[model samples]
Target chain A: MEKVVLGNHAVSYGVLVSRVQTISAYPITPQTLIVERLSEMVADGELDAIFTKVESEHSALASAIGSSSVGARAFTATSSQGLALMHEMIHWASGARLPIVLANVNRAMAPGWNIWTDQNDSLSCRDTGWMQIYCQNNQEVLDSIIMGYKVSEQVLLPTMVCLDAFVLSHTAENVDIPEVKLVDKYLPPYKLEIKMDIDDPHSFGALSSPENYMEFRYKMQEAMDKAEDIIIKEGKEFEKIFGRKYGMVEEYRTEGAEIILVATATIASTAKASIDSLRAKGINIGLLRLRVFRPFPVKDVVRVLLNKKKAIVIDRNISYGKSGIFFDEIKGAFYNIEGDKPKIFGYIAGLGGRDVTPEAISDMVDDAMRKDKPEKDIIWSGVKL
Target chain B: MIEILIHGRGGQGGVKASLSLASAAAKAGKHVQSFPEFGVERRGAPVKAFNRISDEPIVIRSKIYNPDHVVVLDPTLIQSINITEGLKKGGWIIINTDKNPGDFKEFCKNYKVATINAKEIALRNRLGSRAAPIVNTAILGAVIKVLKVSDKESLAIAIKEFVPVKREENVKAAYEAYDEVVFEGEV
Candidate 1:
């Protein structure tokens, strides 16, 4: 059924339809509504699940890890500081190979104190061994969460469905809530092959000797590598079940375009408008919306961007000392390519929830088109000098 | 595409009003999107929410900088906010006040203006306590009247879908405001 619902509520509905057996979450701005709605569903007997109210984000993820260890499908959500608090357990969940799915509303981290939209919080956890998928809208948030479980369980790696705080999290849109049976068909009841059973009684996450530890890390890396294929396969299967299909990277009118603008999260959605307006004016520009951040779709990124003369990467978060996180990653993706790489320019905008308008996006594209080579590695767009 | 900017104080149901409006438009088979601009969110703090209704899907995820229509649930917000700042020319400003549309002639000089005694209508329908009259639902009715985006019945259905409590009173307030809205001539 189609209903106009908040982006956060869409996440809850996705979790509900996925039939997540255990929900452990701590309330935080932007992400709070997701767990609140889930709690209401559980309280009203609408969804059959155990909603665990944990004291902190650490416990929230820890409880989810505990539930997943017992072979139960578990879910949790948080934002900003709460996500930072869960940093330790984040590794624990993935290291133990638990297929826990988490919804992280992307909020800017603070000593300055902010609760608005930014990608820093989620991007900071990039190396934590979790597969990350950033959503452009509420529909993607809902669809990706359902697909997240399918991908995670298949590869035994946890997944984080990240959406911008207040941007997509608070936005309401027409979302087609799939029938329970349809979701059940897409994501069957999760059955773990290796689970903590009292009868079997095998030690999990025990102390590994130096030689054994290297093998475990290698296995986890193998799983991460395997996840890329699973993500694509599940994406195709998702399209067959529901008419909506998603990919690791979405190319919008990139063919024969001189310049392509790359963005993720809601910023990518805005980039589409700039693409449309620029295209209407007969400017040869396109957009590449990166949907999946890790097991970063290197081949797909290379395929779409290699031939393009110039690519402008708009990043909402910064890596401080170096350059835009996405800019660095995309450049690294092209590092090993033999020859003729697109001249990629990175522009950091929308940090601390600053709005990235179509005008700013157009300016970035024009700037990239004008430059023979990046004068600087990263240009902070729209910031007062 | 019809872009709407809803201006109100926190606790005035500005976000809810936008959601109900979007839901009503969606019920009428139009693609709609609504979202609140996150701020302090404390009661009485100035808050704004946006709604977009269109024949095609809304791909733009940015805030509504230029609106086709503006709904001011709190008339007092006019003193503090340029509620019609980026409002397109010939855009409509629906204000919730007892004053005649003529009173806003100079302030709303370049756009079409509509007015309604939404507070009185809300009180008459017992939408909120007499002291704090919630005017968003009633203002939504004025929006429907000005834009003709949806009918009174569809809006009522949306209200029922959105507001689980005080359904009858809110629907009554909407209908009363719809019937009683006064439109100033377009400038």
Candidate 2:
């Protein structure tokens, strides 16, 4: 059934359909509704999951880790500062190789005490060894949770699904809820063969000496490498069952285009409007949305930009002294290439919840047209200085 | 696409107003998106919410700048806010006021002005207290009447589904506003 719901509620519905066994969260702005709905479902006897009302975001994730280690499909959610507080557990959850699913509402980290949507919060956890999927719409937010679990379980890695705070978390949109039977058929119950058992107590994640630690790290890296193909395989099977096609990246009118606009999250959705307008103005511009952020789609991204003349990469988050977070990643993907490559310009916009309207995007395209090469590594769009 | 901007104060269901309108539009077989300008919310502070409705899919996920219509749930908001910042000409400015629609024409010229005593209707239906009336659902009724975006049945269903309290009374209030919606003059 389809219903109009806030994007946060969409995440809750996704968890419900996934038949998650353990739910843990601490209330945070833009992320409260997600857990609130899940709590209601648990309390009202709808979803038979244990709702762990923890004291801190750290405890929230730690508790999820505990449940997942016991072979329960666990879930947790947080935003900005809450996610920051869980940084330690972030590494612990992945290093332990538990298939826990987390929904992160991407809010700008605060020194100014702001609570708005931005990508910096999740981007900061880039090397967490967790699979991350950034969604452009509420439907994607819901679908990614189910898909994230299916792939993560097979690869034995944690998955983090991200959506822009308020832009998605609070916005109301229509989302079709997939059938319970179909989700069940696609994702069966979690049964870990190696779990902490009460009858047979075995220590896990104990002191790792130099002799064994390297092998553990190598095995984790191997799993991440295997995850790339698993994501595509599950995505195709998802489309066959759910009738919605998803991939590492989605292309819009990019065939034979000279210029391509690379955007992520909801900003990519807004860029489509600007692409339509730019197309009308006779500009050969198209859009390429980077959907799966981790196990970062280097092969797909490099292939997409090979023939394009120039690429405009827009990021809503920045690395303090370096370029935009996504700009750095996309550029690094082409570092080893020797042949001609698209001169990718990085434009940082919409940080701290500033509106990146279609007109503002059009202005960026115009600015890109004027420059053969960007004067700087990073250009701030609509900033005072 | 038809974009509508809503003006109200925090704690007045301003955000829910936009949601219900989009819900009604979605019920009417149109694609819709609704979102509020996320702010440090406090009661009595000015708040804005937006909705985009279209027969085709709505792709642009950004703030609505040039809305085709405006819905004002509180007349007092006009004193502190520019209620028509980016509203288009020849569009409807639906206001919830007891005053005549002609009284707003000076400030709302070159547009179709509409007035509905949503506060009175809401109070009569006991939707909220006399001091602070729940006029969001009532104003949506007048909006649908002026914009022809949805019918009374769709508005009723949307209100019944969205409003957390006083569902029957809110539905009744919306139907009354749809029936008693006033127009200042011909556009």
Candidate 3:
């Protein structure tokens, strides 16, 4: 049934439909509503799961890791500071090869103290080996969780289903929740072959010496590398059941276009809106949204941008002194191209939830179309200073 | 697509109103989006929320700038802020006031002014205290009446399922405001 729900609550419902066995999380703004609804669902006897109330995000993930180690479907939700607090455990969750699914509401990191939306929080942990899928709306937010769990369990790596803090977490929209039975049929229960069992006792994360540490790291990378195909396969299966196409990147009107706008999360949605008007005005503009961040869709990115004349990337987060993180990735992805490739331009906007409007997106398209090449590495849009 | 910007003080259930309105529209099978612009974070402090209704899925995940209509949950906000800053001309400027809709005609010249004594209605239903009346439900009722985007049945069900307490009161208040709302000019 379809219902209007907050984006945070959508995550809870996704966890419910996925039939999660364990939920451990600490409360944080934007992310609080997710766990709040889950706890309510558990308390009300709707979802029969062990709701672990931990003191901090660190303990939260640690508890989830514990459950996953024992072959239970563990889940957690958190925001910026909470995610930052879980930084150490973030690496452990992936390195341990625990198929834990985490819902991270991407919130702006604070110095002046903020609780708004930004990509910096999730982008900061890009190297943690946790597969990340940035959502464009609440429906995607809900769908990604179910997909995350399936892909994570198959790949034996953790997944982070990310949505922008308030843009999605606080926003309410109609989301069609697949019946629990349908999701059950789509994603069968997982059983860890090599698990921590009392009868057949084993140690986890004991130590990795120089002889085998490199192999362990290489295997983790291999799992992440193989995840792209598994994600696509599972996403297709999810579409067969749920009637919504899921993929690493969604292309909107990119056929035979002179310039294409590239972004992720909610910014991509607004960019698509701008593309509509630009097309109406006889401008050949398009959009490409990078849905899956980790297991980076390098092949799909190359496939989509191979023919476009110019591609403009809009990032809502920065890498401090370096360029935008996604921009850097796209540049590196196109580095090996021998012949002509789209003149890629990196534009940063909407950091700290400043709002990347359709107008701003159209302006970027117009700016990119006008220039022979990007004047600077990072063209800051909407920055007052 | 229709965008409505709601202006209210904190603790006034402005965000809930937007959500309920969105729910009502969604119940009627229309696509909707609702969210709040959280600032200052204190009761009686000015706050903003938004709603977008469309026939197609809403892909513009940007803050509403040029709202097609405006809903003012607290009438006092009129003096302090530009409540109608980006409101489209000839749209409804729904305000919670005891005075008749004609009183706001001069103030909301281009837009049609919709007035409802939602505070009185909410107080009569005992939805909130006299000092802090919950005008969101009643305001949503007035919004439904002025916009014709949702029906009473949908609004009733939405309010019944949304409110934490006094569910019946909220439903009654919404229906009362639906019948009692006074607006200038034809909708």
lDDT per residue, candidate 1, A1-385, as tens digits? 9999888999999999999999997999978999999999999998999999989999999999999999999999999999999999999999999999999999999978999988889888998899999999899999999999999999999999998888888889999999999998889999999899999999998889997899989998999899998999999999999999898889999877988899998999988989999999999988998999999989888988887888899999999899999999999999889877999899999999998888889998888777798988889899997
The residue pairs found clashing in candidate 3 are none
Q: What is the lDDT of every predicted structure here? A: 0.90, 0.91, 0.91
* lDDT of candidate 3 over A260-297, digit per residue (tens): 88999999988888999999999988899999999899
Task: Give fnat for candidates 1, 2 and onward, in order.
Answer: 0.81, 0.74, 0.82
Steric overlap count per candidate:
0, 0, 0
lDDT of 1: 0.90
DockQ, model 3, C-alpha based: 0.80
Candidate 3 stretches greater than 4 Å from native? none
User: DockQ scores for all the models shown?
Assistant: 0.82, 0.79, 0.80
What C-alpha root-mean-square deviation, in Å, does candidate 2 show against the real structure?
Answer: 1.4
Sort by lDDT, best first: what order? 2, 3, 1
Models sorted by TM-score, best on top: 3, 2, 1
Candidate 2 per-residue lDDT, tens place, A1-385, comes to 8888889999999999999999997999989999999999999998999998999999999999999999999999999999999999999999999999999999999988878989889989999899999999999999999998899999999999999988899988888898888899999999888998999899999999999999999999999999999999999999999999888899998877899999999999999999999999899999999999988999988888987788899999999899998888989999997677998999999999998999999999889999998889898899995
**Alpha carbon deviation, residue B184, candidate 1 (Å):** 4.6
Q: By lDDT, is 1 or 2 better?
A: 2
TM-score of each: 0.97, 0.98, 0.98
